[model samples]
Target: MSEQGSSDTYEENERVLVHHQGKIYEAKVLKVEHTDTNNKRKRNTLYLIHYQGWKDKYDEWIDSSKMLKLNEKNKELQRKPLSSLKKKPNNNINQQHQQQQQQQQQHHSEESDDGRPTPTPSPSTAGTSTTTTTSTTSTSSTKRKRVDASVQESQRLDLSLPETLRKTLIDDWVFITNDKSLVALPRNPTVSDILDTFQQQHQHLEHVKQFADGIESYFNKALGVMLLYKFERPQFGEMVKLHPNKPMSEIYGAEHLLRLFVKLPDLLTLTELEDKTSVVLSKATEELIKYVEKNASTFFLKEYAPVTTYYSRLAN
Candidate 1:
């Protein structure tokens, strides 16, 4: 379980689960809440999650204790063994071969029917016309083609954020002051809102605004959205302040751990996916993304794109 606060629940995009709706699912928590109604306050804490399928349509809520923290070890344990059912063998010969044999037999009968043939050397003919029977046996075995190497490698990967982000979100942060434990943040951060809070700390909203713009412009909208998800808006500045010299991938490694999908353009069945997907993407970077956008919430080892360590980290 993640080291979340007793009072604070975890979100969906940051957690992972399996056996959801009768299928194994690997997902991150998007939201977490407790359902408690007071006379004036209505608190329904439901954790919105982003899993393999459903993208963001379905969410599950339980008491804080029921929410399990997603980890690499847990993911490996969820894998089920593949069924060994084999396909029936097919040994039928081609129809063309049968037709050719019939044609040769007909030609031989016609040749034997020719009236000009009159060679009859009694006992010598019997010896020369001796029949010979020969038998030939042929064996052919079919082997299933192996899965692709790139696909196999991708399947082996655990698509989640880095350990540092995981520890920060679920564990107690190293506190320089008493009564200070940093909570794990949302996968996406609202940059403007975060910059607003930083305005007070920086003593100038414009300076912070400029900095926020830099972050926003650092990557395209898709990656920017990923950044928001990896870090809570409030926690963004802290990560940058702590690792100013690091790349954005390292700074946003936690969101990467969730293994978010990017739509690769002009790949797979594009029309079918576009018609079904709820999340929209731009014309650019369409080729750079992966997975066909669909509502189905299952992640088959064969379906996900090529997984690489470079894409796995936020620092790069």
Candidate 2:
């Protein structure tokens, strides 16, 4: 369940040979768990566990502690006896070397073929009933590729909210989804690209001022007030960095912010008051604990961790 040797690659659903009870077994990963070491005095590492395996033509869950990962080359070598594939003397070493070089070039080219950036739908067409196209231009090619097919039929919603309000809402969401700790927008993401139309509705000046005012107004409230105040300075830093380029809401998706905020109360509900030490509050607060409980079961699904990491910035 742990990386034993020198390879840095481990992928879900890939076939792996592991040693269990002195027998070689084929297994696929069920999950990857990262052991937190920020607070501990030891080196931190991740665990790669394979709970299920194919045995006797039936699927079964087995204790993964007995398993040891085998290198791919070792596994392949094991599949064939050492005597069967004896190396022959190079009667045509020059020709063989050229052929080897050509094959190596082909492999290198194939790996570079994975350089395309994955395209996602524009935020504008989130929930509407229309279709549209959002083209993504690859650096390698001059022609723009249509990545978002839904754009052709998606119903466009009004994105006419006042800039101030939009910024506030987007700021909050960015805090929630990105963990309010991001100093700037990630490279390649423009303001418009991250903001969805649904969020634009809440990004007006009146809305943002109202939300800011509400934070002050509700400073005495039990649920949101304490949480908002704790994050106020960081949120300001976020806004400060976001100014002069695009409105806050445009840079930070508003819907994502709201989802992050709404989860606070539920998160608070789980922690014991006495256990609310500063260390826990800073790293895994009650809200974070709740958020993890709410989503932990799904974090192991192949795509979950990446999305969760994006949202963790907000949680932070």
Candidate 3:
């Protein structure tokens, strides 16, 4: 049995409760032994327990883990004054006293000529009535408080988005348009395809190659674009098939993406994409920020515009 409080060690003859076949029995520890098994180096302790009211044949050795030390009732018994312990009657003594009282009650009933035994209230029963009432009232109040606390905890919110939208946002690549509208790109797009799309759109800008090179370097160093496509395509396809006309932002907005990027290191670790050099990784991250800023417009949703601005400032 496991020791209850300050000590892990238990001594023989200690009173305890042993768990046996889903029932708890009051028992005394007869012997405590530590043995080293042949197959394992660690030593294990076993307790031989003799259950109260059980025959010696039923006594057996048990693991320490299956034992629990004396509970409140036993503790209270142990703490009683010696005078009280001396006055307390054993089970056999109580039974004999009860039989004598019953015999007297039967004799009194016979003298009354009713033959039926009249119920006589015992002094102990009368004394315990008030205690039982007070105990019940206190128990009910405690239960009410626990219920209220549980209800309050259940109602508490963590301020996170719904699970589906959160999963969709983090698992797929999101795109921003010049009009400040958000889009979730199909996961099948290769790194080369993404580069082509950006180059075609910003062909007149001289610095576009820097952004492209940054993206290419990051993909080659950290996680392959092909790997992302493989991991994300099926879920993306299902979402698109369900809502073909809905903008990706409507399905999972920029706020979700903002939260996703906030835990970028955790995401990278979870996806096993952490091999990139710090310089290349940082450059790629900056390129993504710049891409969003270049495309973002004043017409963007109020909730999303601030995220773009924050990343834009970081990039600069």
Candidate 4:
């Protein structure tokens, strides 16, 4: 950003809207980092903001480009969701799956990247798992726009789930959809926490380092729209009420994240991404799944919160 623009706009305590991942949140500036006095003319302005109505932990420093001045026009922008293209997707999220049914026409899940550097991506599309309460790669200032799903024949993209996780998916499906249950909130080892744990222990893994943001972005994006089952929607609404501006990565656990993989191939195919890209994302996903399996007792919950009658009423 021009020093001129930085000088003219926003100051401490000023309220604004921030475009993060595929959504926008209302924020108030706590501090402004502009070192123009050191002759830094071309540096963009960074705002350390507290997302209004959210906890301080979610506060972050974002560059000017990601922010919008608070006004009626921008408020309208904040109210509507940005498409995958407008928000940007990480191809490192390149996990693939099958569109087994023609009726499974869910929009390909979009993802939220950390605020970081861009990894060179091969031409592909992927929906990766992301967690929020801990560490995900910082979103890069430079991002590749996601490929919009086109009007073409859909194809198959698959990931082989380990038998353990396969069973977990079945049980999860039964619990949430059939038994009227919900994964309790403020989930232990949230999606963000799980990813952080994966990064901490597996620093040696190349893909983990390369596509951290992509994995995070895709998971957050998918959870907001594509990942939740119908019965869980009210619980999701409850989460939104509690953490109004926070991402799902902060609220959900491995069980919900694992479900993304089972459906990612479908999310990926929705994009015009090549079949080859699926292989790359699928492999990276396998590694993450293995880690979760190793710590299943720790990362996943054996018991779920029963859906309350009031929450069920919201569904009717």
Q: By lDDT, who's the top model here?
A: 4
* Angstrom error at residue 213, model 4: 1.9
**Residue lDDT tens for model 4, 241-277:** 9888898898898887787766665566666655666
Q: What TM-scores do the predictions have?
A: 0.21, 0.20, 0.22, 0.49
Badly placed stretches (over 4 Å) of model 3 are: 1-7, 39-41, 73-316
Q: Write the per-residue lDDT of candidate 1 for residues 160-208, one digit (tens) a residue.
A: 2233322222221111011122223322333333333344454433344
Candidate 3: residue pairs that collide: 1-64, 1-67
> lDDT of model 4 at residue 26?
70
User: Residue 80, candidate 2: how far off, in angstroms?
Assistant: 6.6
> For this target, which candidate reaches the highest TM-score against the unseen true structure?
4
Q: Which ten residues in a row have the lowest lDDT in candidate 1?
A: 113-122
In order, what lDDT does every prediction score?
0.31, 0.32, 0.42, 0.59
Better of 1 and 4 by lDDT: 4
TM-score computed on alpha carbons, candidate 2: 0.20
Residues 1-316, candidate 3, lDDT per residue (tens digit)? 1122123456899988544432235778888766443325445566667877754434555555445568775344334432443465675533332333344344244322111111212122111224577878888797896786555434322122233432233222221211222334422233444455566766565456775664454343333212222223344455669877753333442333333333343234333223344444455554554444443332123322212554334322
TM-score winner between candidates 2 and 4: 4
Least accurate stretch of 10 residues (summed lDDT) in model 3? 113-122
